[model samples]
Target: MARQLAVALTGAPGPAHRVTLSEVVAQASALAVSGTRTLLGISGAPGAGKSTVVEAILAELGPRAAWVPMDGFHLDNGVLEGLGRRGRKGAWDTFDVEGYVALLQRVRDLPAADAVVYAPALDRSLETAVAAAIPVPAEASLVLTEGNYLLHDAGGWEQVRPLLDQVWFLEVPEQERVRRLLGRRTQDGEALEQARAWVHDVNQVNAGLVLADAHRADLRLRLTTRGDDSAGGSGR
Candidate 1:
């Protein structure tokens, strides 16, 4: 199946291939019907459109799939404050990695279970995690998870990759990604100068870690932008 997918995506021989969003959705749909539960991970740097790609996949698969974001495992701000890591809130060590791995293990066992498996969700407006906010039904065969560290290795994060069936790394131009991050922060009422500082001091540091491990992904994707929306995928 992986070989067939590579053939479908257009690009010269390289570490990554160019694929359309429709093709990605179709691949996810195929997994949804595969009889047993499957975990599909979408990973990328900050502002790399991982959520946008996952949203498109969910729209196509509907209830057959469920989304579990890694952000749901973030440590509380108070905890960060006490640890003196509040300034780097999105770094690798800021999350509950072991807890996240445990949830994935439970969710992965859904094929043999009858009860709904509840997962935490990150409430962006509140900037905190809400426990048991997203439910994955026993009938859902495809579990879609996205976040920055799915492909990251080290600090207990090495356990994540083994639980996923397939992982895709999303990539965008550095300028565009930084622009999105800055826009997001400012929209949340952060001052422009402060947002820029946060982007450089915090987000980019995390981005470097994610990008360095891009080669570990099963597939690499670049979203093609049309106006304000993503049109599809394009090759490097």
Candidate 2:
């Protein structure tokens, strides 16, 4: 059967780019009630509202859905520091790619009554990963995973693509993404100047890489809050 879904953009640049919250929830609900092991991998450039979209979906689905963020698989600070990649922490190479692939494989198997899986989470304030921060229960019917690397074909990321039942690539305007990223950095306690520099130099470059892989996704979701109302049917 074809996957039934909707793509919308919110916080759009102009009236042309808006995607509303209702559109997103409706699409997620269709997948949730589909009675299959629905795996949705939502990806976006840094500040593309990936987390916000995932949170909104989770809230809508409630206990019926469980989320596993790829951020939790980020390489520890010590590992990044050892490799002299702490400054480029969010890049694909800075992650434990093999570990992530293994987790995705485990999740795809959908074991019953198994011990909960421990997932990593990023502590924005400490700029480090907190181990075992999120738990994936045995009974979750839909697994919603979000990150920048889901569509990445480089290195070990290629291994993660086929594991996803459906992959959603999020497109966001560069300027708004920069603004949101800088604001997030400050909220994480970084100085304004430092945040601006990181957004301009680091995050933007990373976003460019993520955007380059957009066509690989099964569905394309524009990240503006207005929502996508295009009449095209769901992807194959």
Top of the candidates by lDDT = 1
Q: Candidate 2 regions off by >4 Å?
A: 1-18, 112-115, 225-236
- Candidate 2 lDDT at 12 equals 20
Q: Determine which window of 10 residues in candidate 2 has minimal summed lDDT.
A: 227-236
The local lDDT score (0 to 100) that residue 5 gets in candidate 1 is 68
Lowest lDDT block of 10, candidate 1: 227-236
Number of clashing residue pairs, candidate 1: 0
Clashes (backbone N, CA, C under 3 Å), per candidate, total 0, 21
Give me the overall lDDT of model 1: 0.83
Task: Compose the digit string of candidate 1's lDDT tens values, residues 88-157.
Answer: 9999999999999999998987665568889899998998999999998887889999999998889999
- Give all candidates' CA lDDT scores: 0.83, 0.73
Clashing pairs in 1: none
